[model samples]
Target: MTTILVTGGTGTLGRLVTERLRADGHEVRVLSRRAQPYAVDLREGGAGLDAALEGVETVVHCASTQRGGDEQAAQNLIAAARRTGVAHLVYISIVGVDRVPLPYYRSKFAVERLIEESGLGWTVLRATQFHDLLVTLFQGLGKAPVMPLPAGVSDQPVEVAEVADRLNELALAAPAGRVTDMAGPEVRSLDSLARAYLRTTGRRRPVLNVPLFGKTYGAFRAGGHLAPDQAVGKVTFEEHLAHRFGR
Candidate 1:
């Protein structure tokens, strides 16, 4: 059995991947900032992380920091993996990180580069934004009387479970550098997505399309972070909402 270590193994996607791998009879090791038995920070490398990586043949890297320091985390992981002679490293990254100008997106792309040059056998999968994130945004926005959204912005939100399944498959296979992109089934406008959330959750709020002036927003407006061609995911945002809310 291939013993695979999953970073950020407790997160939405990683947790699913961990469960799937274990169910399939693979020995799964979970590593994260707070995961029990291997709660070491990847950014702050130490013997703790090294100890976790020992005998870890494959690493499914799902750990990511949107606040910052993702590049540092990848570097630390790469260094540790090299030392431990880990054969395969699988990374999950956001789609259009190379085209998007957002700071968080830039950091994701930088981490992708770090993994690419890490010299360890690696596979990277770029996926669209998860549906749960849209839910979070709408939840926050619905708190106010008026919801504000970037003008001309569209999103293709995929189910997190689907992304997790793909990651699990990648972790089990031989390293395939930069696999095909994963995307949601539909491309809907943010305004429409917000409306769907409001309608489903019964939140009465006027959605305001606020046109923001910035290169980052412009890129979003231009659909730089979208993948209309690779819409292969089976679940829809509404289906996810039904299951999440037990409706």
Candidate 2:
């Protein structure tokens, strides 16, 4: 049995991955800065890394700051993996990292590069935005009759569970360097999604399509945030919402 180490196991995706791996009967180790048997911050070298990765064959790295930080944190992981002679390293990244000018996206892009250049068996999965994110956005929309959204932008948001499943599969499979891009089955407008979600949850709100501005809006309007047509996932937004809300 391949013993795998999971960084950021406390996170939503990380926790899911850990649970799946454990259910599959694999030896799993979760690396968190706060836990008793955790590794320290990967930014600076520490003894905990050496201890955590001992006898681990594979690593699913979910440890990352959404906001960009010094690139050394990723570099440190690479260095630790190499030093420990670990076999495979897998990373989860965003779909539109290259197109999105956000700092977090830039940092993810850089981390992908570090993984690529590390010369270890590696697989990188770029996934679209999660459907849950829309729920978070709608929470702030208040009890208004109309939910406003950036008009003309498109998204192919996937269920976070689906993304986690793919990650688990890749973690067990041979490294493919980069896997097929993953995304939701449907392509829908931001306004339409918000509208549908409101109706789905019985929010009784109409969707107001507001005019978008600047490069971010333009990029999204051009479908830069979506995956290509060939890589549609099985889970749909309707099904995800239904499962989530117990509807």
Candidate 3:
């Protein structure tokens, strides 16, 4: 079995991908800030990353920072991969990174470009926002009596496990650049999702529709982040909520 390196393997998607691959008897190295032997901050490329990428056939890059440093991390990873002759580099990105003008999206798009031109075998999968992320968002907003959500914005959220499964498949198979997008079966509005969250947690919070400004908000409102044609994800947001809340 080829040794695979999974960056951010301690996180939700990485953990799932690592579990699946390891269960199949593959030698999987988890690379994170605290992962032993492979422990190295990807933002700063160094001997640690080179050591981790040594003899690694494939690298499933799942590490990303919302605050900053994602571009630097990918550059570091790519440099290390090139140095160690990594054959395949699997990346997971958002559906609308190229279309949306948000800071995070811009960084993600830049990373994608870097991989595409990295002169290595690469497969990039752009997936819709995760259900877990939506839960986190609603949770943070739910603390207030009235949750202020972006107006006219809808989300087609795929399950994290599904995305992980897809990544696992991509990690094993030959590099296929820019595969089909994976999205939730249903495209539900923010208000509807918030209401479902309220029902699930038995919490009442009036959702306020705040019309956000700028191109980012406009793109989201225009459904730039949606993959209506590729609504291939089976799990619904309601199902995820039920399972999470033990309903």
Count of backbone collisions within predicted model 3: 0
Provide the clashing-pair count of each candidate structure. 0, 0, 0
Q: Comparing candidate 1 with candidate 2, which one achieves the higher lDDT?
A: 1
Best by lDDT: 3
Off by over 4 Å in 2: 143-146
- Compose the digit string of candidate 2's lDDT tens values, residues 1-247: 8899998888778999999999999999998777667757777757788888878899998887865553677788788888898999999988888987667777888889989999899999998888887777886783666677788888888888888888899999998997878988888877777766776788877677899678777777888778867356777778878888888
lDDT (CA) per prediction: 0.93, 0.83, 0.94
Candidate 3: pairs in clash: none
- Model 3 agreement with the true structure over 68-176: per-residue lDDT tens digits: 9999999889988988999999999999998989999999999999999999999999999999999999999999889999999999999999999899999999999
Worst 10 residues of 2 by lDDT: 65-74
Give residue 90's lDDT in candidate 1 (0 to 100).
97
Worst 10 residues of 3 by lDDT: 37-46
Candidates in order, TM-scores: namely 0.99, 0.91, 0.99
What TM-score does structure 3 among the candidates reach?
0.99
lDDT of 3 at 137: 97
